[model samples]
Structures are given as structure tokens and as C-alpha cells.
Target: MTTHYNVQKHNTIYQVKDRILIGTMPPKAQVIEEAPDYLGNILKYFSKPRTLEDSFKFITSNSSLSEIEARNLVEELIENKIISNKKFDSDNRYSRHSLYFDLIDTPINAQEILANKTVGLVGMGGIGTNIAMNLAGAGIGKLIFSDGDTIELSNLTRQFLYHEEHVNNFKVEQAAKQLALINSEIELVPILESISDVEIFDKYFNECDIIILSADSPAEIHEWINSAAMKHGFAYSNAGYIDSFGAIGPMVIPGKTACYECYKNDGDLYKFLDNGQELPSNLNESFQAPSYGPLNSMVAAVQANEVIRYLIGVERKTEGTRLLINSQNYKIYEEVFTKNENCKKCGHFTHHTENLHASFQESSLTDVYVNERENDSFNSILLDSMMDRLIKVLPNTKILDIGCATGEQAIHFAQKGATIIANDISEEMLEVVNNKVNTLELKGIKTLHGDIVNLNIEDKFNYVICNNVLDYIEDIGTRLSKFKGLLTENGTLIVTIPHPIKDGGVWKKEYYNGRWNYEDFSLQNYFAEGKITKSRENKDGETVISSIESYHRTTETYFQTFVQAGFKVVGLFEPQPPNIVAETHPILFEKCSHIPYFQTFVLKKE
Candidate 1:
């Protein structure tokens, strides 16, 4: 059988000065200087599918070239992708897509590849709706999109998928109807619900090939989606507007590129936009930027183009880079981002200096931690025990509360007429503490931010309180010495840490004599003493809520380190859950009573 070849539909042959330029697109074009007259004539034969033998016969009859020379010239054209033996289905809706993809260097079954990919879209307004439309037109196999908002008259300015009749209808439902009309071959799963937690992504988008976030609500949605992308290992991108500019990407392929959190943490462009400036409270909730139709559509088109490129196995231009387009000048600026090795969301470091701060800064986890400390009987008992020693010298005493998460202990001390310096590594936690301080008008407490190891403080204090912080530090002896230096002679040091036994053990439940006991625990690496990483589970015991890293040290190591740092151990206690826990949280109380989870110590500088 004879093989047939045809010139690409988009390809063009033109003359520049005396040279003939034959190419499809800008960079893909090539020049043939002093070209033969038969070259143009031969390409005309390839305008439509024709056998190489027929083209060779034409070349031999028209010119003096032999069949072999004609064959070599045709092979060169095929190799350069100037012509191809592959026939595109002209009747297909995506036929143009196949022609455009032919210009790309990678071999792609454009329509088939896009028809197999699932895209998860979050948001159904402005940029999101446009993205959905673009993807639908490009023949994406399935779209799982979510939005709780109803269409409004204001949305009509930029959200093109809806009409006046769609006003007050749920955005997702209306979007699904409109998208189906655009392409009935694609599948649409419209969810009429607002996404607040990261866990929702696991439930809805786990099977998606890529997830795009265009929603700008709930403030922390970017962080949540980034976390989800990292966890599920899916490609992710975000497109939205920033005031007058349209922002698209930093397209993330988990482990292969910088994630959304990486941009927030270290990207220079992100920092410039953030800049620690607080917007007005009223504006924060109701501020609406002017959403022009052209700007939104332009941003959405570029974003969708990149997504389609990724699905079709072509290089995505936005990978690890964000494109910011100026609405006024129409200038597009690319901001490249690199993955942060210590980023809390996607970092691999187990002993990262900022790991603890990053863990505590997560809004959801911080909320849970704050609530647990405030209401849990076990934490209440621990706080009471620490306060017992401070009550004796509270009035007019100078104290430093290191690693003060939310300033709970510092606020308590300040209320008792003690001058307190509350210090923490997490900026978010400090913000919460500052809010409380301003609300209460507490003048005795001052908030200090930074890692304690590098924190510069000239004043010595009567007491230095380090609670639940030592477990995350690698060298307790050195940190203890620093604590000693921050204290006056004979000053007290109060420390609380996760008990070595509990921190190093793996707990399991065993049925004994037809009754289940949850206290069967064994130490996995109690004697080894190094960094330990654990997954914290939610109440359901199924979902992994978060991962935390801590250093495990033996009780003997802790005591020896204290002695070596010129401190005398005045007291040591294994704190037990308060009796009220037996009634309030019977299960927790029972398990905690049998095994100690926390250890507290009071040391005096010698």
C-alpha cells in the first residue's frame, strides 16, 4: 500500500527577500535559501493527501530530480512536521485542535487525550465560568465544579455562561445547563455547595486529573486547595483577579513544581501583593472589583490553554510560574516561583525549623488547638498545674513566656499583675494573641515574634516558661542553656513536654477476656531518640487531619540535659487528666489515666 502525506492546514510558504520560508508558526518556520522552483510546486501537490510516488513522478516530470532525491526531500518535510501521513478527522469538532497540536513537538492524540481527562473546578463566577466554557469547548471528558452562589445581575458583566433568566438560580446548576448546551459529549458534575475545609477536596476531587481553583472566598481556600493537591498528588492551578490585574497560575504538579503555598511563603511577587497591609473590615467582606468581560475571558483563555496543553502532553507554559496581566495596559508579566524546601504544605524536611510554626499557623488546626486548650479537661489541668507555681510570685514579677501559642498562659499571668513577654514563632498565632491583648487592653503583656534560638532579648526575667515546645527541638541541652541565660540568678524555669513513653510508643487496642482495652502500648524507638513524625487523625479515626514532627528524648536525657545546663530540678510531675474528664470525656480520661501523656518540670538556675 502507498503511504499518503498532506501539508498541515495551518502551514504557509512565503518568500523573504530571495529566500523561501516554509513553516506553520513563528519559531517552527524554516528558511531555504536559493530554493529550487520545483519546491513550491511539490508542496502544492501535498496540499491534499497524495502518495509519495505521485509526488515523485510530478517532481521527475517537472524537474530533473530522480525519484530517490524527491523521496529524501519529502522525508525531510515529514521529519520537520511540515507535512504528515496522519489524517485529522475533518468532521470532528476538535479537528482544529488536532491541526494546532500538530505544530507542537510532542506526539499527541489531542481529542482523545482531552476526552479522557477529568477537571475539577472550584467556583462558577467570572474566571471560573469562562474556564469551564473553554474546557467544555476543548472537549474535556468530565468537569466536577462547585459553587454555592446564586447568579446575580452583577455577575452578568463577566460571567458569560448565564443569562438574565439565570438570575437568582444556583451558579453551579445554571453553569451545568449552559455547559451541556455547549458540548453534550462532556460530563458535568455540578455541586451547589461552598467549600470551607480542605477535607472537601478529598471527597469531591480525589479522582480528578487536575484541579483548578478560581474561587477567592473563605480567604484560606488557596491554602486548603494547595494542601489537597499535595495530598492527592494532582496537578493544580489557580486563576483569579487581584484588584485591576488578572492573576493566573503558578500551575502546580505535585512534587514536580512549586505549589500555591510555596508562592505564598517565598514567591517575591506574592510578597509584594501581600505586604502585610490590612484591608478595612467592611471592604474585606463586601469589596467587589470591577470585573470587565474582556479581562476575565482573556485570563480564563490563557489558563484553560495551559490546562489543555498539560492534558495533551505538551509543555505547559505556566508550570511553576504565574502570569499577571495588567487590565489597563494589557501587558502580561510572568512571575516564576521555586519550591520551598521548608514549606509546611509540600516540604519534605522532617526537622524543619519552621515546621512547628507552620503546623500551628494553619487556621483550622489553630482553631482546634485553641478550643482544645480552652475546654479540654486535660489541658485545663496542665495549665492549672503550671499556674500554681507562678501564683506565689505573680504580682510585679517579670516573666517570659516562650512559644506562647495564642498567649493563653501569658494573658493569665498578665491578669495576675505579672509583667509578661509572650513570644512565639508563628505570625498567625501572634496575630490572635495581639487581637486578644487589644481587646482586653492588657498593658502588662507584650508580644514578641521569632524563633527563641535567635531571639534577641537584653532583659533577664524572674521566670521563663517553655511549654510543649521542647519536644520539637533537637538539642534540649543547648536550648535549656539559652533559657538559663534569659533568667536571673536563682530564677525559675517551667517546662512542659510530651512524655517520652507516649511520644515514642505505638498504641493499639486488644480484646482481653471479652472486653476491649485501649491501653496496650509498646515503645517503638524509645531508646533511639531522634525525630519522629506522626499523622494526627480526626475524631473519626479515619481521616488524617495533619502531620506533626517532634523530637523524642528519654526522661533520663531530659533530666541530664537540665543538670548539664546549670539548672537544679526543683520539681517533676507526670500530669494526669482532671477528674472532670471522667464525666466530660470518659474514653479519653480512661486511656490517659492509665498512661501519662505529658510531663512537667520546674528547674531553678544555679
Candidate 2:
């Protein structure tokens, strides 16, 4: 028996002037124009599911084309998906969905894929109810939704899932009832409890493929949902409104795109509103933003469309971006974000450590570093402060210098009759230290090469100097504890790092009222700990540029880590370049004077 073929359902063919057109409606529509006359007859005969031999016979009888020409046209149509050999059941409820899937370029049917996915919705309010109805209409297999609020007369303005009779009933229960009427084949699980904690997500939505958060209450609910989504390793999306703007977006896939915290770290609203301080007691009262039925439905349509597109294995527009739609002017704006390597929630700390080790190992970097340390006025001022502290304990004290590049501090300590152990990650840098020790005949100076965190040394020292090293180290508390253990009972640890304000801040130019103005330097995501990458030219004026990576941490975090590690802060200093730099390098002097360039902490083991 021969197989039969038919033109796909919902396709239309017509003649425009001397040309014929075959087309279908979008979401992945196929269109063919300027067809020969014989091909039109072939399509007409194939509309009723006829075998290839019958189509060829009918085309030849109706038109002047040869049998071979008709056969080739039918074969090409099947290849292009304008016609299908697979039979579709037209009597089923999802017949139109199957026909829609026929236009897509996937190996499997999309409607079938939708039937296998389980979606969990967090709220049953205006946006949530609309999304639920849309997903149910699209034949989503199972929906697990929760809401604690009871429907009131005000809710009926935007929430379509409830009616006048459902005025006093719980939203989840009424939503499930209305959704069941739309599609009896779908599975609906409704919970009448408000989501207040992150643990509730794992309890209910553990098995869901995707969880969408539409609740706008508690203000911190998005963070809780993000934590749960990241912990469970599931895809999630956020959708809601703020004032007249409806926001949908940032469909997050675990390990693939940026999470909610990454967006929060870079979002504009977060930059101004999140200052790590509690608001006044009266200011903490709950307030609701404006909401309308049309706006809710519009946002819900896009959100639901994104979920469907993701389920069916298509490219989603909201991945790693937030889409804000303005209702007044119908303008759309987008905010794009990426996975932050320093994001406290979804960032990886090991990659930054690995990059730091690889970067300092290069000889070019060490050469430039040594040259800068010798000539940089900023370094001269930092060394002055360091020497002032070390001079009091020299001439018989044991000093352990972590990250002692080129043995600058170790050689000075050894020359003053102090025993020294210089530790560094790069062997090339340690070789330079050894070369200086051999040339100067510096006694009591030993070089140890490896990451300081992993190296084991039994000898205790009176002073441990960690110069510009904490910025590269991720686990500060653990490293501080180890440093405390490596010191004598009354030992002191000296740490120097680039000031967080100068390292993490950015200067942006704004144009307002028809003029451009340079704003004061503002710290971007100052409280969010993450890896920062900076690029600079080498001192030799070479065309090649070197990139440096370091972690940004606030002053409070460093102080807290020191206190937790049983250390007392003896001194905290923000050093400025010496006065001579103003006459020598005026540009560098201006910046160093205006901004706190380096932060030094003198901590004592208690």
C-alpha cells in the first residue's frame, strides 16, 4: 500500500495576478509564491489526503504538466513541510495545536511536549490567574498554583478566573475550578496558603519543570523564589508590574543564564533603593501599585508565551533580559544582564581563584609589576606606612610575608636582622626574590613558592604581612583563621587591599536639561561581593594591554571577618600618595588625592 499526503491544515492558496501564493499564519509560517500552474492543481488534489500516484494522475488530467513534473512537485512540497504524509486527527481538542506544531522546525510535536511539562505558579492574582488560563488553554499537562487571598469585588476588575459568585472564596480554589472547565484533561493542584518562605517552594514545586513568580507582596519574595529556584536547579521566570509599567522577564535557567540576584546586583532600582539599611517603621507599611485588567492580560500573554516557547524548545526573547512595557505610550524598554562571576547567589568562586593564579604566573606581568612598584608614588606611600609598623619589631623578629612579590618587604626585614619567609603562588616571582637575596647576600631570608592557603609551615612568626593579597583570596575568614594559627601568641597580621570604593565604583556621564554633566563617582553594586576585571597599559608603552582580576569586598565584610577569626583591629588606614607625586605625576596625584586608593588594616591575634 502506498502512503497518502495532504496539504497541512490552516494553509491557504490563492492566485495574485499571474502568480500563485501558498501561505499560513505565523508563529513559523511557510509561504511559497510565483508557482507554476500545474503545481497549483497538484496542491488542490493533495488537500484531501490523496496518494502520490492519485495526485500525479489528477494533476496530469487537470493540467498540461507531465507525470514526472507532478511527482517532483509533490515530493518538494512534502520536503518543505507545506504538505505532510503523517495523518492528523482533526476531531481532537488539540487538533489546531498539532497543526500549529506542523509549521515549526522541530523533530517532535510541540503540543505533545506541552502535555509532558509541569508548571508551578506562585500567585493566583491578576497576572497569575491570566497566565494559568492561557497555559491551560495551550494544553499544559499539570499546574501547581498557590494563593492565600480570598477573591473580593475589587479583584474581579483584573482577575478573570473569578466571578461574582466567587467573591468570598479562596482564589486558588476558584481558579482551579474555572481552569477545569477550560480543559478537563489537565491536572490542577491548588494550595490555599500564602508563600512566605523559600522552603515552601521545595515542598510544593520540587517536581515542576518551571516555576513562575507573579506575587508582588513582601518585597523580598523574588529573592526567596530565586533561592528556591537555584537550590532546586529548575528554570524560573518573574512577571509583574510597577506603577504603569508591566515587567516580564529574565527567564532564568540554572547554570545557563543570570539568576535574579545577578539582575538585582545590576538593576537601576536596586542601585538607589538597596542601601542595606532598614526603612522607618511607618515606611514599612504595605502598599499596592496600580493594576488594570488590560495590562495584566498583556503581561500575562507575553509571560505565558515565553514559557510555552521554552517548553517547546524554541529561543526565548526574555532570557537574561527584563522587558518593561509602558502602558501610557506603548513603549518597550529592555534591561540586559549576564551571569556575574561575583554574584553571591549564583556565582562561582573557584573560577576567579583559578584566573588569579594563571594571571600572576606570566613573566610579563611580574616584570611590569616590579617596575611599577619601584616607581609608583602610591606604592611609596604604602611602603612608608608598612615600614613604620615593621621598624618597631625588627632586628630579631620572625616575619612571614604572604604574596611577597620580588621580596621587597622580605629583603628589607632581612637587612634589619629579622628572619623572613616569603611565600608566593608564582615560581617566576619567587625566582626574582631568590636572585635579589643571592646578589645582596641577604641572610635569614627563605623563599617558599605555592598558594599560601594550601602551604603548610610549622614555624610561627611574630608578624604576618598580606600585601594586596586579600583581593584575590575568596575565603577571607578561613584564611584569616589560618593566619592567626601561623602567628605567635602576640603576633600581628598586616593586610593591604585596594579600597573597595575606588575598585568597585564607576563614573557615568549623564545628559539632563539639554546639557551633559559628569556625576560624582558612585559605587556600583558595592555591597555585592564579586570578581572585578580591570585593564591597563603596561609601563613600557607597549600596544599590548594586561587584564587584572580581583575580588571586590566592602570594608565591613573585612572587619567582620577579622572579628570572627579572633583578631582585634589595631588600625585601619586609607593611605594617600606622597606630596612629591603632585609635582612628578600630576594626573595620578589628582586621582589618588580625591579617592581612597588603598586600605591597610593592622590586626592583632587576640
Candidate 3:
């Protein structure tokens, strides 16, 4: 079979007498044209797909080159990734982006990674709108943005997504509409509201693969985003501009880098997390550093560059370093900042940092649950204990078990005469559940594979259960709202998150990433939220260790999301280990009773 080839759109070809310059950017070029006139002629037509036979025939008719000579030249270009069946040429939408596909040393799969991702933009202003459009132009598939303000004539200096006609239209809505027009292939969702609290702010964070923070939001709100990102283990970028000077973060990755709190707290800076109940305003405004269009554009473009590099499998160069751009002389400079050891957001927090290399989506990468979900004794300890608590509040009607790995709870519930939907992100786990459903000939149970945020279905459920998933979810508030909407009038939502108040707080050592020693221990739990460490031994008697990230919103933020979503919590259960384990491990029970391994919320839609 013959393969068609096309030149990457971004490649700018320069043909001289003895040298060939081919690159998207003029500064970088590679030699493709030597003295061979046939080679240059055949390669120049790569903007559209063509076959070797077609190239050979064209070369023979125009340049007096032999068919064999043309064949060898085309093969050489294919080997150099200059042309192939990679198909960046098909879509006229990506005609400009074709240069990026050609210039970046990363593979063609990077295109898929960027196109399939969804991002959240917290402010749809100058920087935010620019960043959003840049990403959509680069083939980002989905974006959700928020801005309460309407377009004003004053905004025209920087916010180019609007004009004199869009004055009364909401910024978010206009940005979304404009971006959609540019790339109809992209999904643009807009929120015409302000982010007043953690609950409202978190909803956007929940749905995005990575959240971007830009202009208009206060410092205090940005602090919460940093905390939420670390608590949920998602990466976020902070970008903004003022006057001819502008800056883009130090994109924060929870366990891998120091968060915003770390940067401010370095020189005994007052920690925002330590403030009392009310949100504090940043009165430290020294000057109103004025900004213009050119500055905002430069900062946003760099931030988007960092975001794209991160989406693909490229090593992140901007971590713990902010890129400062000066429009005065149009110079770019890097300011390196080291990760703080006593960082409030992630310093005392401990989790497996290896997953930072992957996308922020919760992936079921390890197959540890493959055979385990099939066992009859699967998670029996928590299953039995939580079942007793669940039966009290959860109605026996239609139920949805989200993050239900291998139908452990869903299968059990279905057997007890309750209809259930077993949803999980892992297809392998679902396959196991399906096999068990077939073998036992089970009824009243079905399987759906998807991420909880985007899984669309009719809204008629009596009960919704989300278990052990909050640590990986950036926005709990938005998810709760969706669950509330899905429920019947009196439907119940059963949410279980890792508890900071679980029993047996004793620290122990294991093979890798075990409990922290005294120095790190004293520095932990300073905030209302942080990581909780645990250990287990594998079949080979080798100890394996991991950490669970838990946000202490109940004790910290007063569970404001429930009220905002019009939910009333009827029951709250903190269950300890069964009596038998407590009797066997008396010391463990005594010390850890201060914390429960898990906490449950039984919320009824009002």
C-alpha cells in the first residue's frame, strides 16, 4: 500500500541556489534543497497530500529527473517527519497550527492530547480571553470560562474578543461565542457570574483538565485555587499583566512544586489559610500598575505556551519559575524561584508525585483493581460498614454509583433489590463487572464508562453515591450541584471523602514514601486540609505506601456548597474500624479514634 504525504503547514520553505531553509519560524531552518531541482520541486508541494508516483511523474515531466531518483528523495523526507500520512493537512481549521505540529520536536500524538483536553479559565478578561482563543486556535477541544462583567468601551484596548457592538453582552458569553466562531470544532461553555466563594470558583476547576487564573480575580481567591489544586492534585497557571511589565507563573503542580502559599510565606509572610472565617481583602495595593494590549498579549501567549507544553509529554520548563516579559524593549527573561520546604499548600502534604507527568484527569493507570474487584471479599471491611450506614438514608429506588470500581457497591446493592448504574473511568474494571453480571446472571445493574463531570444522562435518580473520588477532583462544589440536579425531589446524595479526623493517627515507616519524621510531622496539619499517609504490604512482604489528599472544608469552610446548592444534610457518619480489628489492634484504635478513615455526607435535595 502506498502512503500519502503532506508538508506541515507551519514549515516556511526558503529555496536558494545551494541551500534550502524549511521551518515554521524563520530563525530555524533545515536543508532540504541542494542542487537537485527535482527534489525541491517534489518536496515544495507537500502542503497538500501527494503520492510518490504523483511526485515522480511531476518530476519527470518538469525537471528531467529519473523515476528512481524522485522515489529516493520522497522516502528521505518521510524519514525526517517532513511529510507522511500524519494528516495534519486534512483540516483547514488547523492550517495555521500545522506549523506548530511541524516545529515542536514532540510527536504527532501531542496534537491529539491538546485537541482532546478541556481547560477552565477563571477570568474572561484581557489575559483570559487571549489565552482561551490561543488554546482554541491550537486545537483545544473544550473550554469553560467565567466573567461577571459586561463588555465596556474601556476594555477594547486589551480585550480584543469584543467591540463597540458587544458593550452590554457578558464577557464570558461573548468570549465563548467568538471562540466558537473561530473553531466550531471546540466546545465553549460560559458562566455569566462572579466567583464569590470557594464553592462557585471550584465548579469550573472541577470540569477542566487544568485551570488557568488570569486578570480581575483577587489575591485571596487565587489562594483558594492554589489550595484546591494541591488538595486535588491538579496543576494550575497564574498569568497577568500590568503596564509594560507582565508575568506568568510558576505553574503549580500539587506535590511536585511549591504553591502560592509557599511563595508568600517564605519570609514569614502572613498565611491566608490562617485567617479567621471571613475572606480578607488584599489592601497591599502599592500602585495600580497600568497595563495595555501588547503587555497582556505577551503574557497570555507565554502562559498558553506553557500549558500546551504541559498537555503534551514535554518536560515542564516553567515550574517554580515565572517568565517576566518587558514590552519596553520586547525582551524576555526568566526569574527562577525554588520550591519552599515549609510550603503551606504542599510542603507538609505527601502523595505519590509520579503522576504529575500525566494529564490531570484521574486515570486508572495501575491494574491492581483488575482481579481484586472480582473477588467476593472485595473491600469487605468498608463495604459492610458503609452498607449499614447507607441503608439508613439511601432509598431502595434508582441509584447511581459514580467511581464504582468493578461494581463493588453497585453489584451488592443490585442483589439487594435496588436498581443501580455502575460508572467508572476504567474500562478494565467495568469489563470485570460486566463479566460478573453475565456469569451470575444479575439484574437491575448496568455499566457506563466515563469521567463523572461530563457523563450526561436523564435526571431521575433517587440516590447518587460518589466514593473515594474527591482527592482527584478539583471542584467538589460543581459536582455536588450536578448530583443535586440529577436526583428526584427527595433524592439523597451519599458522598464519602478521605477523613482528616480518622482514628489511629500514628505515623509508621514503609518501603517508599512512608510516614514523615518529626521535622515534617510538626509542620503538618497547619491548614484545614493536607495529605494523610497510609501503608500496606504487598504479596512479597514488601511494604507499599501511598497518601490520601483530604480537604477539611467541613471544619475549615463550613460546607458552604450544600447551602448554595439548596441541599440539607440529614445525616453525617464517621465510622471507625469494626469491633474485631479494634480488639486486635487496641493501640491503633485509641490513638486514631481522633480521625475516621472516611467521612460520609447524606444530603437530600431540597
Candidate 3 lDDT (Cα, whole model)? 0.67
lDDT of candidate 2 over 89-111, digit per residue (tens): 87988887776666565446788
lDDT of each: 0.79, 0.78, 0.67
Q: What is candidate 1's lDDT per residue for 1-606, written digit by digit as tens?
A: 777889877778776565778873567877888988777777777888988888778878888788898788888888877788888788989888777777665566678888999999999889999999999998999999999999999999999999999899999999999999999999999988999899889999988999889987787788788888888888989898877888888798987877765666443232344553433245365666678898899889989999988887888878887777878877665666767677777775322112101232333656655656555535565566656655455456899999888777788889888899999988888898999999999999999999888988998999899988999887777788789899988688989888888888876853222123465778787898888886553221222345688898899999988998998898888877778877666556666788897888899987
Work out the TM-score per prediction: 0.55, 0.56, 0.49
Query: What lDDT does candidate 2 reach at residue 357?
Result: 14
Top candidate (TM-score): 2
- The better-scoring model by lDDT among 1 and 2 is 1
RMSD to the true structure for each prediction, in A, is: 25.6, 20.6, 24.8
Model 2 alpha-carbon drift over 4 Å, by segment: 24-34, 268-286, 349-606
Better of 1 and 2 by TM-score: 2
- Check candidate 2 and list the clashing pairs: 342-530
User: For this target, which candidate reaches the highest lDDT against the unseen true structure?
Assistant: 1
